[model samples]
Target: MLQSLEIELTSNKKQQPAADQLGFGNHFTDHMFIMDYSTDNGWHKPRIQPYQPIVLDPAAKVFHYGQTIFEGLKAYKTDDGRVLLFRPHKNIQRMNRSNERLSVPELNVDVVIEALKQLISVDKDWIPTAPSTSLYIRPFIIATQPQLGVAPSTHYQFIIIMSPVGAYYTEGVNPVKIFVESEYVRSVKGGVGEAKTAGNYAAGLKAQEIAKEKGYSQVLWLDGVHRKYIEEVGSMNVFFKLKGVVHTPALNGSILDGVTRNSIIQLLKHWNIEVIERPITIEELYKASQNGELEEAFGTGTAAVISPIGELNWQDDVLIINDGKTGELSKKLYDTLTGIQMGKLEDPLGWMVEATPVNV
Candidate 1:
């Protein structure tokens, strides 16, 4: 068991927004969890305090060197008023992997999880109760040592904040059009692509912006070297259903090990579906589409859960998938995953971790 965390309630509780208007990442909870680290003291002063701006020196290492990592998860409020966190341990484990890649201090998963439970208990009311809505949790670590000489910082800060959010994409669960990016690459082999760091996302902004301008929802990135192998979507893992089989890009040191991606693979296997993780080139996918073998396409992530891809725009060829409608398998996976997350389905995998009850 971990030590108890200090709680400091806020005097001003922000008014919660209506369920329909609770767009993605617009509103934050009243309290946030924080812990500090140093080379000498390690992690200390775990607490839940009022949500406020953090004060850091302008010359902090994070500002110059970009030594930071983050993880995204959600807290669902069940119909019976119980808060459920899905596969939170997996997210923390990935966070530690990101820390290792970024040269930051590793965190104790158990202690951080305990802190998250305490923080959620204090601000449980912030969790949305509407369908397809939940409290998005963001945990991150940043190097804080003011003197930035390129080496790893001696001081770091770990923080967790909650935001009540709806769908990540404006299209929600509807099928969206994606542009296959050819000019810019998101990551490469032996790079920081697999790590959940800010720089990786920052590097994709240019490609994403170009895709958006061309009337697409997201960019489907290809391999950096060959630029023909399908990698992933802008913020999610990409999957292709061809000839009654599911294929996703292999985690070849470039693709992120997404929690939702892993869960979907597990669920598919449980249903006796053939799921293959290997290098899938865009040419092969286009050939399958031409042969009417490409049945469905979707992207998986915490923010959107499962987003169906209706159209893929690669060069001058446009392949419309499943008649621009959601696929049967996509709908089934979305319903099953969301049902399990919302406490409506039997959790055979035991992925949901219940938060401590809140008195208020």
Candidate 2:
């Protein structure tokens, strides 16, 4: 039996006219879940309170040293009116992995799931019904100890907030143009690249801006040492198709193992798609594209799912792959993945977990 948790609710009385027009990470819900941690007390003072500005010292470690980690997942409403979450256990395990990398405390999986269930129960109406739209849940930890030292803080705060988001690309499902960064790198061998830390994003922002200015949608980052092998694209794991074989960069220390990436791998195996995880170089991709052997290219992440990449801008040349449109395999993966998420298909893997309801 699940124990009912205490949650103090302060509903947003004045409904904003723009609530239905929520873009990605644009609008937030009414309440948030919060818990504090310390070396002596472990995890304590768990509560669900109204959404408001958080107060923090100017010299907090998170602000100065960037000791922060975050996770992204969603809650969906089925056509039959049942609410479900897709593979939340994966997110919990990933959160623990990130915490270990960032020197934060690990949380129990059941406790975290229960706390999230209680939260979504209160804000269940926030889930959107639009195609590919859902309530995005963000769970993050920040070092709150107010000190200037460059070490990990003894105090931390873990919070989960909900936001209604629409599709990632508003320009339709067209393929993306990626800017290959031969100079700047997203991660290194002995760095915190694999962890979903805040600093990694802050560092990648400049490169992203440059890519945008150059008419590219995202940056295709490469390894730091020789810049010979591919790493990742913006916030996604990339895949390339050559000779009917699906090849993606192996999980080196720099590349993040995305949840969508893992799911795609599993789905490919289910379909008997020859998916290979190995090191891929821009030169090799260029050769394949030039030889007319490159069949398709795409990127996988939780936010965008499987976004097709039609053109690759390597150096001063642009190489177009596929039909300059979303690949057929990309559509299949997207449909199957979103189908399972929206409860439209049989959850063969038992990934969809029902949320506990709140009493009126």
Candidate 3:
């Protein structure tokens, strides 16, 4: 384990992007966090340096075998100029889970969280203060051993990059239409679906492309094997409000146990709302939708917080939900979560963490 964190400030800084034009993942911050790992030396050479392109060998294992893991989070600027991180510890823990599943070396949770704080502090000005805007943080580990063998690489690089992004939904939380993918299956049980890895996303690109062509915002993936059970909605965990109960799919090794998903469950419980976690079939959901039992549907994740589902197209049958508008509960949840995240509301759950500067 590396104890000392070396800091190298950038000699030349680029012009910052205007908050209004700060699209998602377009512009990067001035500095980034990077750490190297090897079988013999363990994790070492932790440093914060200028954001630049990484140089890896042409035969790197990540390029050939797809051994990489990543995690996404954000930092918010409060009215009083304090930088806040929402549930950053949860993301750090998930990053290690992804590393374990990808055969990559696990990161020290505390040290990695500290690295995030220090890195964000170094470039704290990059955090946007516009409405629903934030500095997106991406931490990833890639197999860099330049080996052609179909095995875990002996070397890895853990890197953290920051990008200032605007709100996910510009004109309020209008629901998005989802396309149910019948041809392409995302992941099955005992697969890498649960991990935040690059391969799982790579596998979804075809389906996503198809959905985009069909005039849908994203693809709602069902279970790969049975193709009946609802697994996840795009990159986020899904929820359906049927009758008066809220139902979300259980973590069955094939679905990502999202941080936002867990937080939403907790919040519902805190609010005394009936929430259940179990296997839900697509047919069941469709039947409920047909009978007008399904009141609202939404997807929860770090990016959108709450993306309400206005319609679901399965085999050309479009099921309009909540009158093709955002639900009241979805709006409330989004408002509360964003308020807490931006240090505007009382975080009774203690989810936000401040990245305080120490005269860096």
Candidate 4:
């Protein structure tokens, strides 16, 4: 374990109702953890200050170059009232990988974890007790050096903030519709698609809005070059069940390697399920859906543990999955995953990290 961080706690005295709602990232806790980085000073000036707006120069490198990266994870309040985090180290490691891609300096994994622990320890009351609800932690890095040049900023700020959030899907754990994009592409071989950067999502919003207008919940992105191999769904990694086996797109530069997705693959493989990490094409998925071989499909992310895909709208054609209901495998996977998260089942994978207890 790393050394615990020194924090200054500030309570959100008046706005208690907003925190109680936990409707995703709408409300924030009173305090946040922040650290600064520079080429000379490295990472310094760690503090837990009141949740407030950050002042950045108009000519900051991040403002122009868009050199920013972020990671999302959750803190869960168990039935025993103990708060815990699910695989935070995975997020830290992935954030470092994202930093390397975005030309940002990397923080030590232990330091990142300690910073998160400090933030959660100060805002433990923000962790909701409702079923399937948790405190979502957003940790991000940004270039702060005020330079108009198109180079990486020498100064940076890393911060972690907490938001009490409800379940992502309001329609319960039911199935969702996906729009297969044969036209718009998300990432190419040399692109920054694998990194959790802000620009990637900013570029995806237009397509996502179009998807919503077309009666689809999310867009299933394909490779930019070939436009054949499936990459990932919007903001989530995708999994396909065919021939009683699990198949997902390989981590081939364009896919975001989700912590939940990796965990599900490991869980399936542990149960002797043949889980293949390979290139699955949209045509292949369509064929499987038509021939009754497609058993299940779901998208996995920190926000949405697992969202079952009930239908796929590809242009004029429609493909239904498992009779347009949550399949057996989808239910089992979701139950097992959430069971471990809510502390109702054994955490054999040792993914849960209990937060330091504090009375609100």
What is the per-residue lDDT of model 3 for residues 1-360, given as tens digits with 9 covering 90 to 100?
435899999999989989889877989999999999999999999999999899999999999999999999989998988889989999989988888888899888989998988999899888889887899999999999998989999999999999999866553478999999888988999899999999898899999998989889889999988898899988889999999899999999999989899999999998999999999998899999989999999999888889999999999989999999999999999999999999999998889888866577
106: Cα error in model 3, Å: 1.3
Best by lDDT: 1
For all candidates in order, the CA lDDT equals 0.94, 0.85, 0.91, 0.86
Model 3 TM-score (2 dp): 0.98
Q: How many pairs of residues in model 3 come into backbone collision?
A: 0
Writing each residue's lDDT as its tens digit, candidate 4 over 1-360 gives 224345666554436444336667888888888898999989988888878899998988888999999999988888888878999999989999999998999889988887777777777766777787888899999899998888888999999988888878665588988898877788788889989999889988888899999888889888898888988888999999999999999999878989999999989987899999998888888988788899999999999899999988877689988888998988999999989988889998788998766542
Clashes (backbone N, CA, C under 3 Å), per candidate, total: 0, 0, 0, 0
Model 3: ten consecutive residues of lowest lDDT? 165-174
RMSD (Å) of each candidate, 1 decimal: 1.1, 1.8, 1.1, 2.0
Clashing pairs in 3: none
Clash-forming residue pairs, model 2: none
Task: Flag the better candidate by lDDT, 2 or 4.
Answer: 4
Looking at model 2, report the run of 10 residues with the lowest lDDT sum: 11-20
- Residues 298-333, candidate 1, lDDT per residue (tens digit)? 999999999999999999589999999999999999
